[model samples]
Target: MFTSDYKYKDYIQEIYKTFSPLSWLLKIFSLDSLSRGNKQKFASSYWALAKGALTFTILAAINLFTIYYKFTWFYVELIISVKYADAVQMIYDLCQYFVDLYFVYKYGSDVFYEYIRQYAYIDGMFGMEYYGSIRRRLINVMIFMISMWFSSSLSDYVIWAIGFGLMSTTFFSMAYIYMFIKILTNLHVTVHIMHIESRLRVLGDLIQECYCSSVSCTARIEDAVIKKNWFYTIKTKTSKSQLYPLKKISYVNSNEVKWLSRCYLLLTEQVNFINRMFGMRPVTAPCWTKGLSQGEGLPIITTLGRRDGYRTRYEKMQAAYKDLLSLVQSQPINFHMAHFMRLDYPLLVSICSVFVTYTIILIQSI
Candidate 1:
């Protein structure tokens, strides 16, 4: 029952044309297409073997240099042969392998979410896509725990000492990383929630506009009337409750009803998508707070201890919800407002900072 004011479909087409190749690359990995020759070959030749050989060779050289610097000029005599060193050297190589795999999984999913954000930008220059990729990367990294543990084991201590001052720097900074990840993930979830909500509001406005328009109303009134009668009939028959009678006193006709029904179905589908996006499907463990009221082990972000900074953000989100309510009540929903509402700007800034800090750490480590 909704009508577009402008040619949104054309814009969507343009976005797809511009961004399809990137999406296609992500889809290749996202779908787990291990059997595909290109994927398998890429993994074996470029990722698996090449990376493995290079890392092992580097580690062996490092071991040789360590021995030579410490003791005699005959580094090979002090240690086993470089060939034998390859075996123990593989330990470091294995670490690097998993770290690289973790990076692929991390940044790969990040790039995919980034594509989604870019598409959203076509709808409007909404910033939901801004930190969306960060959240996806963080969550993927968290879930990909095996790779993280392996990274720690493979850490080149000597390299880190020379590069980053000392291993103790990373050790001391670990909690910051964890906190940043948690905050980023939570903010991401909230942003996604806002995006879906905004879309629904826009669709709702479109439906209202289409129905309230002169041409569509005139064309569909007869259909709306017939369907309204059928609706009452079915509903009355299905329920024995006398709370309200199935009144045949409805104004809508069949065509209008049909149009509205289609609109309602679309809206309902969007709702379902929102639920799924929030991870409410097959209900898993909650991300942040659990209880209705904040308490121990709650993800519901409350102000206490060193968390006072989040209070302002929490209030801002609450204010955004208020704006959402006002938009839903207005005609021709303001998607610009709705779009902005989905992002917690403060949280986004924080997450962005985390990326900056982590990148600095990674660079320093290297």
Candidate 2:
């Protein structure tokens, strides 16, 4: 009932055209397909593969060089001054780059293209005003990304150049490129989820309309009969609720319910797919505090009693350590699955219950 006359292939092409700018950005980083001629071919060609390797190699080289330079020029002084925090932070940032790079390389354009293809198919399943909304959102996102990229790129260079000298600007620029790619990846997934959510809402409205229509039909018939007997003016008061009593009368057919359920299921599966593709380890403030205490504060604490004349510095370090310890102890460490369920015994039980429930549903359907 909700089918559209627009061809699926044509629809996909239109979507691709709308998102060409984003694809172009990914192409510059060698993270997406090289050619725009065939939206179906998501895998990069041999040349694109070589380009990607070269791109990664250059980034790796810059990172390694930056690390070497920092250690050679600033590491000893920072350690002597008890300011090695900067060095540590740089290490963490560089590690994040490598981690993101690994994922980008592993998934590449094929996974993203598949996501788009599946999104288009599901979106087409429900007849909604497709092009106008898609284009508006895509354009807004493109504009935001472009502007953010420019502003961030400029800021990174200025900050690094002032802090670490002009030589380090190139290193930071490479890092920013990877960071931008990661942001784009996340943005794409978020946009898909939003589209899926809209479709699910439409499905809900359709089901509601089905029920409303049934009730309205019954109401109209009652009104017609009452109007026909207009000569019998001696009428007793009758409420609308009395005329339309709630009953176990199925307004929607089983087949219609099945169809709606299938649509809901498809949307849910797509959400799961997006989650799996983009899932990362959740980090909490308590975890970071604990790590900092163990990694950075422990050594300071061990040497506190041994230090001879740095009494004031030792006092400050002791106070900081106390604060860190207190913070860590006060906060409980609990991991949650996207804040939906805690990773505890209860979650395990829920998983088993879900399995049983689905099994029952399968048997009943058969």
Candidate 1 lDDT trough over 10 residues, lowest sum: 296-305
Error of 1 at 151 (Å): 26
Q: After superposition, how far is residue 239 of candidate 1 from its true place, in Å?
A: 40
Instruction: Give the root-mean-square deviation of each candidate in angstroms.
Output: 19.2, 24.0
Cα lDDT computed for each candidate against the true fold:
0.34, 0.49
True lDDT of residue 260, candidate 1 = 30
Candidate 1 accuracy as lDDT: 0.34
Q: State every prediction's TM-score relative to the real structure.
A: 0.27, 0.56
Q: What 10-residue stretch in candidate 2 is worst by lDDT?
A: 282-291
List candidate 1 segments past 4 Å from native.
Answer: 1-169, 207-257, 280-366
lDDT score, residue 319, model 2? 49
Give the per-residue lDDT of model 2 (tens digit) for 55-101.
Answer: 66776676677767766765665543233444454555555545544
